[model samples]
Target: MRIVDVCAFYTPHGGGVRTYVEQKLRIGPQLGHEIVILAPGDEDGVVERGPNARIVTLKSPRFPLDRKYGYFASAEQLHGALDALAPDFVEATSPWRSAGLVADWAGAAPRSLVMHADPLSAFAYRWFGQVFSRRTIDWQFSVYWEHLRRHSRRFDHVVCANSDLSRRLAEGGVPRTVTLPMGVEPGRFSPLNRDPALRARLLAACDLPESASLLLGCGRLSPEKRWPMVIDAVNAAGQQSPIGLVMFGEGRERRTILKHIAGNPHVRLFEPERDRETFARILASPDGLIHGCEAETYCMAAAEARASGTPVIVPDGGGAADHAGDGAGMTYAACDPAAAARAIATVLRSPRRQPQEARTITQHFAELFALYEDTRARVRMAA
Candidate 1:
């Protein structure tokens, strides 16, 4: 079947969604299917990934919040692309206007809302989480919940990349929520990718020796990431022992991160690694990763670390915590830097253990595509 993904969340320097779509492009053809991406870009064009996969870009203006991303303003162009492509299955990753567009599209193809983002956690809860309870936050964002419910009722299925997100959606009145957790590329990321020289260099920047514990933090440098909290936790943990944190990410909050890490020698922020090999090497070289974002739908960084035989410390809830199982890693209370510091110290004191099982992107997409086929079959039968 030919599948077209209408993605408004995709960006050139995106963290997880970009990685996922790229992986899907290769995996789809391997499964004897065609995959196409329709996204907003600075210009309109088509870029072929392979014989069965390609990206169709629609000319759009830069998104106001971040210049790295673009927003689709013209529905005519989007619908025109969908009409020309004529996909057998349509999937939308964004829960905003893009999902609404897909829902209202006059197409025969069975549509799926592959819920990749959690706006409630990413925005509302992140903003007021420290002040208001989650229950209160949810009540305040009733409009978004209703919006999701309306769009969900029109879709064949609502696929969530994490069980936590699926459960949340199901409870929030979105029907047909399926828990299909995403995965990493095991072949590309592994303990074998660890580079001793790289590790030493990063530690040296912190003015620390090889014996010091080197932690990593990654993702888009954004408000939702709560990077300032992570830096505080790392700083607190550093009080007792020599520890260094090397963060990889870039975004509008770069200056905030810089200010937070000012006068601190143990924490350093670096640009995200675009090269897969170099990224894997940098990821595996660290003793562990400390992620402050509790709102991740699927913490790809944690999963990649797990696949790399590196431990991870994540917030006590959400997908990141789920991925950081006992053998995989550990967790601390969300938004609690003191607790995070303790968790960091505890991880440093404990032994490192490789994850019992490493999940692969290939395995994940195989199941996802099979589900797509089944959903299409069911839709046809119902018709």
Candidate 2:
């Protein structure tokens, strides 16, 4: 089978989207498939991956707000490539204007819209939460929901990373919305890699002893991440007992997040870890993963923390909450610092839970390809 993915978020320095696409390309050939990625780049070029995979880049202008990424503007170039490649299956992984570019293409290939993020929850709600209520925001964004429903109705399937997103889209009348949870890299993180010395050193960095509790906050430090609330919760919890938060991430909101963490000695933000082995050790070393974001489509960092045998403290709602309470996890009401602080203290005092089985990215691709194959067959039969 031959499949093509039209993705605009696959940038050189992108986060989750880039990681997911790279893993799919790596595993496509092993599943007896040829995979092609049609993406916007600095120039038109092609990079051949092992044998059955390649990336076709088209010259494009920088995206608004973030210059690190680009958008698809030349419909002719994108459609021309799809015409030439003639893939059996196609996927548009971004919900931006580029998605319409893919949807407009006259390819006979059955297509899917695999969501990269939940704009309504991640952006709209976070941007206006301080000023408006949830019902008011939903009413204001009714046009956007209708827009999504209109476009997604054309695709064979609307793939979501979590049930919350799938349910929302389905409720908004998007036909064939399917939930397929993403998977973690196998052997990349484990409780066995937990280092006592590293934990002690991290605690000491915050002027605390080995007995101090350490919490890990891993994600892009954007406005939507709600890092300020996490910092406040940690500070409040630290007042009662020795506690420190080590956040690992780098993003456009670094300065803002740093400002929010200012005057708080127990919370520190660090650059994203590059080496997988080193990051795995650091992840497993933390006592618990404390997160404040309540609008994630699927929180991979929380999954990694649980897979590492570390307890978790997440908001009461969102994708991350789905994995809570399975082992050593606790959920507090969203946007409540006092509740978060109490939850943190409870998790620290609770008995340690053994690491649960982590799903592998390879398995994810295998299942995804099977679904693509089935969709292709169904589309051909209908034609």
Candidate 3:
């Protein structure tokens, strides 16, 4: 089986979607599938080849108004590429302009749209912020919804990352929806590979004491992430326990988040380490992972942390619960700093240091991959 993946960006220049695609490309070959990637160009348009896949890049001019709008490559260009590759299945990771083109070009071929995030949640960022008025946000969301309504009917299947997203799509009258949770690479993010020396070095670099309790939050620093609530919780918690919060990842909310944490000696926010090994070590070394976001479809960071034997504390309402599974972690109410702090405190105070049953979570990924393969095979037979 040959699959063509259409995404806004590819690895080295992308985020969660790219990581998920790369994981599939790496593991899918073992299950008898060849994968190819189509992504927007950076610097100069050029083809870059990977071990199990080949990437085709198209030059996307960065518009002054919206940098992301460049993902809208010409339909002819996209169709030309699809004509050349003629993949057995085409998977679009976003509902962008390029994705619509792919669906049109795919014809009767199996085409799937994977919803990684809630479109409404994204709409809040794109238009409802201080930069744009509430009216603008409403208009943009309406336009987005209409666009999705039209193009959604074109795909053979719609894959949602969580039940929340699936519910939202169902409410919007989308057909053939399936919930598929994201996966984590246990080998790359295991606790067994933690380096004590690296931990000490990292703590020292952050001006944190070696004995201080460390709580970690890893994700984009944005409004949707609700990082301010995390900071507030840490501040409130510091009044009781000797806890220090360390956050990884950079985003648009950096200045606001830093200002909120300013003058608080117990909080430190920095960009993530370039190496995955170092990042995994940090997660393993932390006392617990703090997740403040309520809109997560499936948080890869939380999954990785749990797989690293570190307990996670997330809100009760989102897809994070699906990853928490069987007391491997705890869940708190969304936006409740006190509840979050209490959960983290409980995990820290507990004497039990039993290893988490992360193998079960890894098995979930294997099952998802099996399902994907099965679906792909059925699609091929029908085609």
Candidate 4:
């Protein structure tokens, strides 16, 4: 089978989306499938992965807010590209204007809208939360949800990354939404990777001693992530126990998050881990993973942490909660620093939970391709 993914948010230096797509391209051949990506780039070119997988880059304008990414202006190029690829299955990972472009394409392939992020929860609520009440924000979100429903109906299927999005879509009368949980890389992170020396080093970086609990926070430092709340929770926990937090990632909210952690000697900020192996080892060494974001779509970092046999403390809501699974973690009420602090202390004091079973990248590809094959057969029968 041949599959083509049209993604507008995928940049040269993107985070989870990029990682997911690259893994698919790299692993598709093992399942006897061909995959290609149609994405916005600085210049039009083809980046070859192997004989059957590659990325087709189309020149497009830069995303103003973050120049690292680009946005699709029109469907003309994408429409032409889809016609050329003539894939058996097509996927639009972007929910922006590109969604409409994919919807308008007159292609024979069965298409799906791979909902990677929740606009209402991740953007609308976070951006307007201060100005509007929860009820008001949800009511206003109905407008955006309605807009999505229109375009989503154009595709054969709508797949969500987590249960939070699936429930939201179901509540909005889009019951066909399927929840396809993403997988973490196998072998890259494991219980065996835990290093005592590395754990001590991380604790020392936070000005903590050997007895301190080293908690890991990995994600973009942004307002939506609520890093300030995380720092406050860690500080509050530090008052009662030997706990420290070492955050890994950089973003626009760096200054704000840094200021929030300035008075707390137990919290330290670090840049994102560039090397996957080293990152995985460090992840395994942490006593636990503490997350503050309540609007995550898939929470890949938390999944990686769990795969590393590190317990995770996430909000009771959102995709992160789902990633925490049944055994490797616990959840606190959303946006409550005291609750989060208490949860953190509890997790740090308890014995580490064994790593739960996680879907591997190969397994994700196999399941996704089977879905595509089924969707394609249905489309053919309908036609």
Residue-by-residue lDDT tens digits, candidate 2, 198-306: 9998888776789889999999978878888999899899888889899999887899888888857777788888898988888889889999988887788888888
TM-score of 4: 0.96
List the candidate 1 regions with Cα displacement exceeding 4 Å.
Answer: none
What is the alpha-carbon lDDT for the whole of candidate 1?
Answer: 0.88
Which rank order by lDDT, best down to worst? 1, 2, 4, 3
Q: What's the distance in Å from true for residue 229, model 3?
A: 1.8
Clashes of each: 0, 0, 0, 0
Q: Write the per-residue lDDT of candidate 3 for residues 160-204, one digit (tens) a residue.
A: 767767876777677778887665775677768656676665556
Instruction: Give the residue spans of candidate 2 off by over 4 A.
Output: none
| Candidate 3 to truth, TM | 0.84
| TM-scores vs. true structure, each candidate | 0.95, 0.96, 0.84, 0.96
Model 2: how far residue 139 lies from native, Å? 2.2
Across 1-383, the per-residue lDDT of candidate 4 in tens digits comes to: 88889988787785888998889888897788998999998889999999899999998999998899988776888788889889888899977788889889998788888887777777777788778996788787776767688988888878887888888788777646888888889778898899999999888887889897889999987777888898888888888878888899988898988887876777888899899889989889988999998888889888888898999999987889986667789899888999999999888878877776777777777887899898888878898
Candidate 4 colliding pairs = none
Deviation in Å, model 1, residue 62 alpha carbon: 3.4
Question: lDDT of each prediction vs. the true structure?
Answer: 0.88, 0.86, 0.71, 0.85
Q: Rank the candidates by TM-score, best first.
A: 2, 4, 1, 3
